[model samples]
Target chain A: MTIQTLNPAQRTIRTVKPMPLARNRFERMAWIFMRFSGLILVFLSLSHFWLQHLIVGTHQLQFGQTVARWGAAGAPVTIENVFWRLYYVAIIALAMLHGLNGFRQVAYDYLNNRGVYRGVMIAATGVIAVVSLMGLVALLGGATIVK
Target chain B: MLNGLVTTVREGARYKGESNQWMWIAHRISGLGVLLFLVTHISGMSFSYFNPKVHEALIEIYKTPLFSVGELFLAACLVFHAINGTRIALLELKPEWWSEQHKATRASLLITFVLGAPTLVIMAWKSLSFYLATGR
Candidate 1:
């Protein structure tokens, strides 16, 4: 006895749908950036921790120590000072961006309403931009370096 | 209820080669861990702009033995998350490297181990010494 197969016309022919590309390229870039910046931040922040907390000890993290290392005043504008400033800039920028993107992801997941989502995104961006600018100013401003 | 819990736990214990899923979970956890640290750090660092005396006091409090131990845990999470994240970013962004994703993952793990072992030792040494000295 031979088995009978279904007719081609009666058989189901399903087309596989392609995965949807992310709607917001900026958000996609931010997602990719969170991972990239996070990797760099781990090295940066951990080394900073080692130097500030472990090596020098947190008790020694006074204004004088910070100013001497990072402050632009009194300290000559030497290569080391410039390097330290750049380093702070990198840390501040990376941490702020990465953390903000992570917050954006959380907001998207939790806030389903479109208006609320838009508001959250705007608020997060504003906060991150303002804080990052303030941080840069505080870090680079020579005024904190008391003579 | 107990049976259901046991069944769920047993199912979770089995790994069927879903590397991406595991990486995603670890990335989320590590991201959150770093964010938690960031919140405290940002607030603390801001104090530098304000009253220096209060900043110094806060720093002194953090110098306690407990925080040293916490730092070790944070370091571990940060190291793993960072390494794995780098691997994912490279694989996703660089189409040429997609074929070598497995190799890249292994390499990332090796790098994480190499970097993390020293950090773990350093943190352990610091914590132990602090605890021994403080007897707290």
Candidate 2:
């Protein structure tokens, strides 16, 4: 394996420059996802906050009220209804994806033990998935209060 | 984790901190805080399907003075995380400009505080009014 005694294939390898450590493609995608999702969420989430908390004021927040705004129990599929429904769905989807991925990133960062990290990641993914599913189900049409 | 945080802070107290170092710490802390809130919020709201009563009560609690303060903190965390994240993303996109990160971190933080101050006043008005009326 000495360079002076290199075979043709070995000499070819030697002639080429050393490559940089391979980047994890999944991680690179995740990094890109985080930035773009974050940029989008800034607008989505802020408007959501302004609408729900600031304008409506948490004082007036109620299940019936939300059901109404969420459309149907509130109103028919008018433009306003469609707008709010779409808005809610967008925020829910993006925020959940962004938040859970962020949680995973931190878990990878601080949890050095492979077994522990795996357990944590599995549990987190399952829990977040189930909860988010329930949210989407309700948003689509699961239950709206009679009131 | 709390112990680790305490240890890191204690150890780092020996040296003068760099702005980016402090900014990174703030970013992690705020991100984690928002993540926790997101979990609670989605989980709670998801109950609106199966248990509208529970959803009502949970959402109601947020209107209380105590919860208003917590909401303020959550909002602050969200705003800062969003703004600082923009800074990080910008720097990452232009690696050559990382040389200007110290300035970026300062500017980001100043923006966070500027945004946060008005937000605090506006939100705190709700909290103060609720407390004044109910003494809660």
Candidate 3:
């Protein structure tokens, strides 16, 4: 009973069997997120490498350069840099979501107890959420670490 | 009350196990691995910024087999997660685009191979080259 969804890019996919007709379609959204994030990562990673390693040259990226680039007053913050930060956050966030969701799917298939399944989802989500928040804070706390 | 406490604890453990099953298992494991590497990688890279001598020294350490093994493992985790993730995403594609989700997954794998292989090679070469030039 696999369900198919249409994408803006005109692609189609056969996914898990649709449970109820009026479900919130959360997994569908998660699936979309993975593709978009993956596509963005391709660009973000490449640009980051090109900028830090190729354009500026790897040797030149000192603390001064890093600080300058981030706090360049009005340098427009280049698309690459903005994407770099977003890429970091997005990959972490999406990876967690995709992975956790996959775990849930597997548990649903193999684990017999429905009660156990719900419990697992809650626990997994809680751990992932807390850790992700901590990671975000650490990543944003550049001043303390970078200097 | 004693029974309740035991039940609560048992339920808690069950939930943790349940949530971390399957793809989530891979996700958590890989996520943790990547995160750990990222922290070390940043710190090591920071050496160059704070002090060139230290930075070069850290880079030099990368030449050893241990570092290579770590890098290889990191690459493997990254590639695996990326490819499988893309497959899942392809499974959500519209019916008009692909008659079957499995087909989409296969195509996604193709794309993954195309991108991942070159990136891995470049990363390895660059890292090795850095170590070779500076015997720090």
Model 2 docking tier (incorrect/acceptable/medium/high):
acceptable
Give a tens-digit lDDT track for model 3, residues A6-49.
87877677777557644547666655665787655545544554
Q: How well is each residue in A8-55 modelled by candidate 1, as lDDT tens digits? A: 777645554554576567767777787678668867987886687567
Candidate 3 DockQ category?
incorrect
Off by over 4 Å in 3: A1-87, A107-123, A145-147, B1-67, B76-91, B97-110, B133-136
Candidate 2 — which pairs collide? A68-A74
Better by DockQ, candidate 2 or 1: 2
Highest DockQ, which number? 2
Across B1-136, the per-residue lDDT of candidate 3 in tens digits comes to 1343355446655765442234445644555565456546655643433454665667556656577657666765666566655555445454465556555555655775686676667666766675677653
Per-candidate TM-score, chain A: 0.74, 0.76, 0.53
Displacement of residue A101 (Cα, Å) in model 3 is: 2.7
Per-residue C-alpha lDDT of model 2 across residues B106-134, encoded as one tens digit per residue? 89889989977787787788668767887
Task: Put the candidates in lDDT order, highest first.
Answer: 2, 1, 3
lDDT of 2 at B9: 75
User: What TM-score does each of the candidates earn?
Assistant: 0.72, 0.83, 0.50
